[model samples]
Target chain A: MIKVNQLKKSFNDLEVLKDINFEVKRGEVLSIIGPSGSGKSTLLRCLNFLETPNAGTITIDGLTVDVENVKKQDIQQLRKKSAMVFQNYNLFKNKTALQNVTELLIVTKKMPKAEAEKIGMEYLAQVGLADKANKYPVTLSGGQQQRVSIARALALNPSVILFDEPTSSLDPELVSEVLQVIKQISTKDTTMIIVTHEMDFAREVSDNVIFMADGYIVEEGHPSQLFGNPQQARTKSFIQQLNEKH
Target chain B: MNFDIGYMFSLIPEIMEYIPITLFMAILAMILTIIIGLLLTFMRSSKLKVLNYIATVYISFFRAIPMLVQLFLIYYGLPQLFPVFTKMDAVTAAVIGFGFKQAAFASEIFRAAFLSVDKGQMEACLAGGMTKVQAYQRVIIPQAFRNALPATGNTFISLIKETSLAFTLGVVELFAEAKMQASNTLRFFEAYLAVALVYWAIVVIYSFLQSKLERLLEKPYRT
Candidate 1:
């Protein structure tokens, strides 16, 4: 489980996340759907300390840290507790797909090479990329790279997995393959916070859903309740716009 | 001055004796250059004000001063400033001078290469639980080294030619040996011409090697 309180982040004069707070229970799937510039990605990044919060506190799996007064050890613990799947896939360009997953296990977790390779192969197989394990990120398609990234995140077995617009950067034809991987992952008992624009996918997969706009959570409820019978005018209008576009 | 083809051909054996000396200085200088250059690069990129300032000043000072003057300073000025340096041989002084000067230039190439890597790579590495050092070692630096290969190769080739300046430090490398051969035989044309030819031939061979190295390093990154 994760608990974030009084989280606020600003880039100089422009405030992105304004005193936001949220939580997800163990094995829960929380999908955050919002328009662009809603601070969804920024909020996700702040959770892992990738983008340091100006003021906040985050607790994950019994470990807590005051963001303003954080030490090096706190950041390391936070990073170890969480794994991120980037929108860009961000696979190590020089490393093959197998190495991408095995690297973290071997280097950070201190797992033996043989054990890491075994788990790495298992995760690669899960993502349906076992055949392309030897190919570098440059040679892999965007979808394949994203799946490899997912395998890498899964290999770490972190307390939470953060997906930041995993399908947003892919071509339309490629988006389904990545979304299918996420769909497959959703069936497992994994805690995930996905920042996505796919309204239908968010409704189909997420147990809980939150609508955000202008750095504020406008509404939160069961996806069926929120998507089927939304309360806030903004949430309804935002969903309407997405529906019209689709 | 008439070209002395026969005499130049005759001097080949004598000049060949000094090839190792030239290569030793160049190879040593290049090794020093890479180490010092990477250190300076890290310093220049660091967030600390004093460290960044020191690296900036060092790069400017070494780059602004001529290579010949730098050689003279390390060889002549060091001994004057500190008596301990007087015992340091000409070869050591030349290698040190060339190393520092080439490091200044090589650091820029490395810095640019480091800058060219995608910012997301580091983020992904850290999110995967790697410490800063691990991320750099496993992700960032390897990619940066690949990007830096061609430029670093150029730096090595120039370093080899720059060893010719060791003649001024009383180190009898290829150029110094040719100078003595010229003075002794008074066939300055043949001796200097042969030296130029040797340098050119070495450069041509190195260029071939450089291309091969570039291709090898480029393999993984190319789609």
Candidate 2:
């Protein structure tokens, strides 16, 4: 579980996250949807202590993380519990998909290469890329690369995953396959905070949705109620525009 | 002028003999240069202001002085400057001179390559529980090495040509051998051409290897 209270972040004088508060229950899927620079990615990064929060506390697995209060070593411990899947996949181009997945197991976990590889194969199998595990990122399609990234994260077996625009980089025809993988993930009990533009997918897979704009969480609710009947005028207006375009 | 086929054929066996010496110096110079370049590149990229400044001074100092002068300073000036190194042979001194100078140039190439490796990849590797060194070794270095390869290979080829100047140190390397042969034979044109032919052969071989290496590195990504 993760708890954030009055989290404030700024880049120089420009405030990016202002007095934000949210709590994610264990095994729940929370989707953060917003326009560009709404601080969704920043919030995800902060959860993992990748971004240093300036004026707030984040309790992840009951350990408080902040730039000032947390010890240097504890921040690294927190990062291990939370994995991230980037929109661009971020697979090391030089490494085989399997190496990308097994790197942590061998290096951090100190598992033997053969043992780490067994686990790696299992994760790659989970992502349906087991047969392609020996190939490099450059050899993979966008969807396959993202799956390899997913397998990489699953090998970590973290408490939660933060997906930042996972399918935003994919072709329209390829988006469904990725969403299907995520949709399958949502069926199981795993915590996820997905930053996305796919409202329908959010409605289908998310336990809760928080709509953000101008660095503020304007609305938050179950997807059924939020998408069916948006409470805020801005939320309604934004959905209407998206609906009109579709 | 007319091509002297018989004379050229006669010189072939002698020219072939110096090829290995040329290659040995070039390869040795490159290996030493790459190691030195790697050290300097790491220092330049270090966050500590003093270390970075020291690296800057090193690069500028060596880069500003002509390489030939540096070679002379090493081969000639060192024994005068430091009495103990007087025991050191000319070959070692010249190798040190050429390697260090080439390192100063190649270090910049390495720096660019290291910088170009994705910052995200670095963070990701660290997050995956790799220490900074492990992250660099496993994730960052391989990627950076790839980016640095073409430049490094080019440097090696150029270094082979540059070893011609090692004749200054009295090492009896290829160019020195060529000079001795020319002066003794009284055929500067023919002898020098043979040396040029030897250098050309080396450059051709290196260029071929570079392209092959480029292809091999490109293999995994090739569709």
Candidate 3:
């Protein structure tokens, strides 16, 4: 389980996340949807300590960290509990796909090379890229690179996976391939927090959905309830704007 | 005096005897430059203000002054500043001068290379449960080096040419040998031309090796 309370963040004088709060039960998929500059991505990054919040407590699987006074060990432990999939598919450019997946296991987990390779290849197979293991990321398409990143994240077996707009950077024709991979992962008992703009995918796969606007959670409930019948005026107009654009 | 092609050819083999000295100085200086440059990079990148300031001043001073001036200072000026330096030989001073200048340039190259790597790579490594140090060792530095190869190749080629200055300190390198041969034979034109050819040939060969190294480094990055 993951829980965040009174999370507040600001850049110098401008507040980005204002007293935001949310929680996700184990094995649940929670999707955070909002317009641009609504602090959705910042919230996802804060959970992983990529952007430290000015105030809050993040608890994951019984380990908690106060945002203001975090220690090195706490950060490492918190990071070990979660893995992130970035929008740009930040694979190690110098490494082949197989090596990218195997590096963390060998470096962080201290697993034997043969064992790590086996698991890495298995995850590559799972992502339908087993044949491309020898290829470097520069040679792969955006969709394929994102899949490799996903495989890399999956191989670590973290308690939760935080995806910050994983498809936001892909070309239109390539979006489905990556979304399909995430959809497959959502079927398993993996806990996930996805901040994305893909409303249909979110409505289809998410167990709970939160609508954020200007750093505040305007509405929260089951995906169908929130997407089908948004209660607040802000949530209604936001969903309306998205539907109009579609 | 007319240029004598045949005499210059004859002088090639004799002058070539000192090729080892030039190469030895260049190789030693190259090694020292790499070590000092990396250390400077670390100091510049460190959070300590004092270390960063010192590294900055060091890079600036070495880069600002001419290589010849630096060589003279190390060989002639050093003994004046510190009496112990009176015992230091010209060859040692030449190595120190060339190596120090190369390090300044190399530090900038490496620092720029490290900056060229996307910031996302570091975040991705951290998210994978790797420490900051491990991320740098395993991911960031490797990619940064890839970005730095072409510039580093240029630096290395320049270093090879710059070693010619050592002859001014009376180290008897390729140029020094040619100078001596010309003084004896009074064939200044032939001797200087032969020395120039040797240096040109060495640069060409080293450039070829550099391209091959670059190709190997770029293999993984090729689309």
Candidate 4:
């Protein structure tokens, strides 16, 4: 469903993603665990063209996006196919939760207002915030706001959903509500590429886990294999460090 | 002639006549300033280099020139250059001069408001699948207007006081009317005192409106 080869990116002289190659099958969950500033978030952003890659090609369903040639219609279609949930939530503070979801559907997709609102309410209910649909983002807890953000992405029916440290901003108590939502979402056929620090959640949920450091994917295999008995000294060292962390 | 308190108070009918004309100029100049000021703001923020440069130069030139000089330029300079403008009166010239002059200042207020808007709001709007125009209208511009409302109200209070300068151009507004009354009746002190009272009353009312507007616009964002 997704493919990348020699995917290189850099900010000026500082390379962020160096010679990364990876692929994921349809309906698979791929978790990218990495150190701070390892370009995991940048890779997620590149998938949707929010931040254009500095080099290399990303192909999804035969649509190629890269530095040389990216078609206009393909980018728009790719954006629809890939939805992103940010750490900050990025909800429009001026809009209610209902307005947030229905906004793009009505404005960009040209869905009828009434139809969009109905579907929006359904999604809000799915995320367990049906009563809070009319409330502004300011009125919501960090966890509730993150759920609203998930509903917003779900309403679009994207093929691939990207999560960038989704629960990083929430309280420890609130993180479960958001993680539960993601766990429930995983039961479906939707593909997911999650970048997160929640090790237990990552180990329990991800079908494949890739450990990254210094802009390179140092290890990639089934999570059970990588988490159980790893081969590399660097991978075992980072996992040992992470065991002491939690 | 010991301050003739009773007689000075009796000039009510005379001062009332000038109030409407004064308000008319303030309202007209305010309307003109906001419309053209918004245009200048768009030019200043736009990508076109020449247009942005022109907007910058226009703002600097008007802001640098004194209002009195701007009034004189419109009243005296325009008549000499265009014979067709000879029929235009002092009131028209005052509106033209003050309106353009205030626009330079108002554009800065708008620019600041536009800048304070969160960059993420636009990106999120686009990610939700909104087109560029839809994102700007739905997500960016409304929030910018809310941010701009309080600062723009301050400009309105200053504009009302600036109307006093219109009298210098011989527009016969409140200040000019008071001056004419003082000179004719030899009640210079009483006449100027009435003018002061009138200006104070207008400002007090406008200040109340400014606070009311700020409160109403801020209701949604106040949390």
Candidate 5:
């Protein structure tokens, strides 16, 4: 389980995440949908200490981090519990696909090379890219690269996976393939917090959804309750706007 | 006033004898420069204000002064301040001098290369449970090396040519040998021309090898 209490973050004088509060049960998929500048990405980053929170506490599984005074060990512990999939598919450009998946396993986890390769190959096959294991990221398409990144994240088997708009950077035609992979993983008991603009995908896969605006969680509930009948005026209008666009 | 093409051609083999010395100085100096340059890059990136300040001043001081002046200070003047420097050989003095001066330029090349790597790469490493130091070792430095290759090649080629300056310090390198031959035969034109051709040939060969290396390293990133 993950719980956040009164989390706040700011860049210089501008507040990006203000008094945010939420929680996710183990094995639940929660999707955060918001407009640009709504701090959805910043909120996700703060969970991993990529962007340190100004105040509040983040409790992941049994470890609770006081964001105001986190130590090096706390940040490392927080990262160990979660893996992030970036929108741009940030694979190590110097390594082949299989090496990208196995790098952390070998370097940080101290797993033997042969064991790491075996696990990496299994995850690569899971993402349907086993044949492309020896290929570098540049040699693959954006969709294929994103799949490799997904495989890399899955190999870690973190308590939770954070997707920061994983399909935002891909082409329109390529977006569906990546989404299909995510949907496939959603069927498993993996806990995932996805911050995305793909409203349809979020509605389909998320167990719970949070609608945020201007650095605040405007509303939250089950996907049907939140999407079908948003209680807050802001949530209603945000959903309306997205509905019109698609 | 007469130019003898055959004599200039014949001077090549004799002048070639000193090629090893010139190469030795250049190769050693380049190694030192890269080491010092990497250290400076780390210092500049370090959070301590004092380290950053020292790195800035060091880079500025080396870059602002002429290499010839720096060479003379190391060869002639350093022994006055530290008696141990008196034991340093002419080749050692020349290599150390060149290394310090060229590192200022090489550090900038390394800095630019590190910056060229996408910010996402580091974040990915961190998010994957690697520490900052491990991130640099496994991902950041390797990519930065590829980016630094072409510029480093240029620095090395220039370093080879700059080894000619070591002649002033009584180091009998290729250019110094040519100078001796010129003074002996009183045929300054042929002797100097022979050395110049040799230098040009070395640069051409190194440039070819550099391009080949660039292509080989670029394989992973090739689209």
Candidate 6:
């Protein structure tokens, strides 16, 4: 389970996440949807300590971190509990796809090379890229790279996986291939928090959906409730704008 | 003023004898410059006020002064303050001078190379559960080194040529050997031209190796 209370973050003088609060039970998929620059990504990043929050406590699978005085060990433990998939893929440009997946295993976990390679190959096969294991990231398509990234995150076996606009940087035709890989894993036991702009995918895969606007959570409920009947004016207008575009 | 082709050819064998001295000093200086350059880069990026200030001032000071002046200070001036420096050989003094001066330039190249790598690469490593130090060691440094190769090669080539100034401190290197041979026989043009050919050959060989290494490192990034 993951819980955040009164989370606050600021860049210089400008506040980006303001008194945010939420919870996700184990094995639940929560999707956060909002217009651009609404702090959705920042909120997700704060959970992983990527952007250190100014105040609040975050509990991931029973390890609570108080942001005000978090230690380096606490941050490392937090990262160990969760892995993030970035929009740009960000695979180690120097490593082949299999090496990218196995790097942390061998370096941080001290697993033997053969054991790590076995697990890496399994994850690569899971993402349907087993044949591309030895290929460097530069040789793969953007979609393939993102799939390898997803495979890398899956291999960590973290308590929660954070997807920050994973498809935001892919070509239109390649989006489905990457999304299919995410959907394949969403059915498993791992908890997930996804901040994305793909409304249809969110509505389909998420158990709970959150609508954020200007750094505030305007509404939260089951996807049916949030999408079918938004209560806040900001959420309603934002949904209406998205609908108009479609 | 006659160009003696035979004398120039004959001078090659004698001048080549000092090639090892030239190469030893330049190679030693290059290694020192890399070590100091990397230290300066880390200090500047350390985010501590005192470290950053020291690194900034050090880089600026070393870059502003000429290599010849710096060599004189180390070889001639240092002995005045510390008697121990009087025992130091001219080769050691020359390497120290060249190392300190060239590091300033090499640090900037390293800085730019580190910056050229994507910010997301470090974040990905961290998210994957590696420590900041591990991230830099395993991912960031390898890519940065590759990016730094071309510029670093240029610095090393220039350093080789700059070792000729060590003759001012009385080290018998390639250029120094050439000067002695020219003075003994009064064949200044032939002897100097022969030495220049040797320097040109060394630069060409190093440049070739550098490009080959660059291509090898580029394998992972090629589409």
Top candidate, metric DockQ = 6
Cα deviation of B77, candidate 5, in Å: 1.9
Reference-based TM-score, model 1: 0.96
What are the models' TM-scores?
0.96, 0.89, 0.95, 0.86, 0.95, 0.97
Residue by residue across B1-223, what tens digits does model 6's lDDT show? 5899999999998999999999999999999999999999989999798999999999999999989999999999999999999999999999999999999999999999999999999999988778999999999999999999999999999999999999999999999999999999998999999999999999999898889999999999888
Candidate 6 CAPRI level: high
Q: Candidate 2: give the clashing pairs.
A: none
Q: Tens digit of lDDT per residue, candidate 4, span A1-246?
A: 888877877888988888888998888999998778878888788777777677777777666677457776767767777788989898888889999888878877789999999999999999999999999998899999999999988888877888989999999999999999998888788789999999889998899999888889999988888878877887898888888887
Candidate 4 C-alpha error for residue A33, in Å: 1.3
- Candidate 1 ranges beyond 4 A from true positions: B1-6
**Tens-digit lDDT track of model 2 for A121-199:** 9988888889998898888889999998888887888888889889999988888888988888878888899999998
**Residue-by-residue lDDT tens digits, candidate 1, A155-243:** 99999999999999999999999999999998899999999988889999898998888988889999999998999999999888877
Measured against the true two-chain complex, the DockQ scores of the candidates, in the order shown, are 0.82, 0.51, 0.82, 0.53, 0.81, 0.83
DockQ of 2: 0.51
lDDT of 5: 0.95
lDDT of 2 by residue, B31-80 (tens): 89999898898888789989889888988898888878988888788889
Model 3 ranges with Cα > 4 A deviation: B1-6, B42-52
Please give the lDDT score for candidate 6.
0.95
- True-structure RMSD for candidate 2: 2.9
| Overall lDDT per candidate, in order of appearance | 0.92, 0.83, 0.92, 0.84, 0.95, 0.95
Clashes of each: 0, 0, 0, 0, 0, 0
Each candidate's interface RMSD, rounded to one decimal?
Answer: 0.9, 1.7, 0.6, 1.4, 0.8, 0.9
Model 3, range B1-223, lDDT digits (tens) per residue?
5888899999999988988888888888888888899899999999999999999999999989999999998998989989999999887898889889999999989899999999999999998889999999999998888888888878877877888888888788888899999999999999999999999898899889888888888988888
Better of 3 and 5 by DockQ: 3
Candidate that beats the other on TM-score, 4 or 6, i.e. the better one: 6
Fnat of each prediction, in sequence = 0.83, 0.49, 0.81, 0.46, 0.86, 0.86
